[model samples]
Target: MFGIFIQHHVSKPNPPKKLLCNEGNLLSQIDGKGTVYTRVGGLSCNYDKGTLIISDKSNRVALNIE
Candidate 1:
């Protein structure tokens, strides 16, 4: 599965969360407190190849290939 995961500013000791999907999707408006282990605003993904595209509030895209 492939997808991007973001951790928005939320209320400490935020546990790490992972999302895996066969298709691409977006998650937004997440509320939590500790340093975001991962923070993303947008993502593009292809699960079969384990490829992922992630972006931050600045809209910078990063690719993860596996």
Candidate 2:
């Protein structure tokens, strides 16, 4: 349920449902709804006290990348 902003327009409607990361040679994933995704960019996070922090400044759930 997301979309990418490109040329000042979103690529599609109701985007995908999952995201994956292969950073630091480690596997990380975020998923929802009925689809799955893997992308190189999404969130800026940090691991603290056994928890992964995505964003602390906004209440927005989905990411819109161009």
Candidate 3:
């Protein structure tokens, strides 16, 4: 099963962010629960490895924007 979370803002030109979580069975590799975590943003990235980087040095998993 694959799960993703996207953020939405009112006045922002682009979407808030893209949070992707993938979990499923492997084809023929490991016969166990597989999980992958990744973070992507619409126009800006809160994480440094993605598209954009933010100045806020916080690693909270959730965000509340209104």
Instruction: Put down candidate 3 lDDT per residue, 1-66, tens digits, no spaces.
Output: 122223334333543234332232111122235643234332222433342333223543333322
Question: Model 1 — which ten-residue stretch has the worst lDDT?
Answer: 1-10
What TM-score does each of the candidates earn? 0.28, 0.27, 0.15
Q: What order do candidates take by TM-score, descending?
A: 1, 2, 3
> lDDT per residue, candidate 2, 10-57, as tens digits?
434454444332342212343465454454343555444544445434
lDDT of 1 by residue, 16-47 (tens): 35533334553332335643333333554334
Relative to the true structure, candidate 2 has a C-alpha RMSD (angstroms) of 10.4
lDDT on C-alpha atoms for all candidate structures = 0.42, 0.40, 0.31
Q: Which stretches of candidate 2 lie over 4 Å from their true place?
A: 1-37, 56-66
Instruction: Please report, as a residue range, the 10-residue window in candidate 2 with the lowest summed lDDT.
Output: 19-28
**Per-candidate clash tally:** 4, 2, 0
Tell me which of candidates 2 and 3 scores higher on TM-score: 2
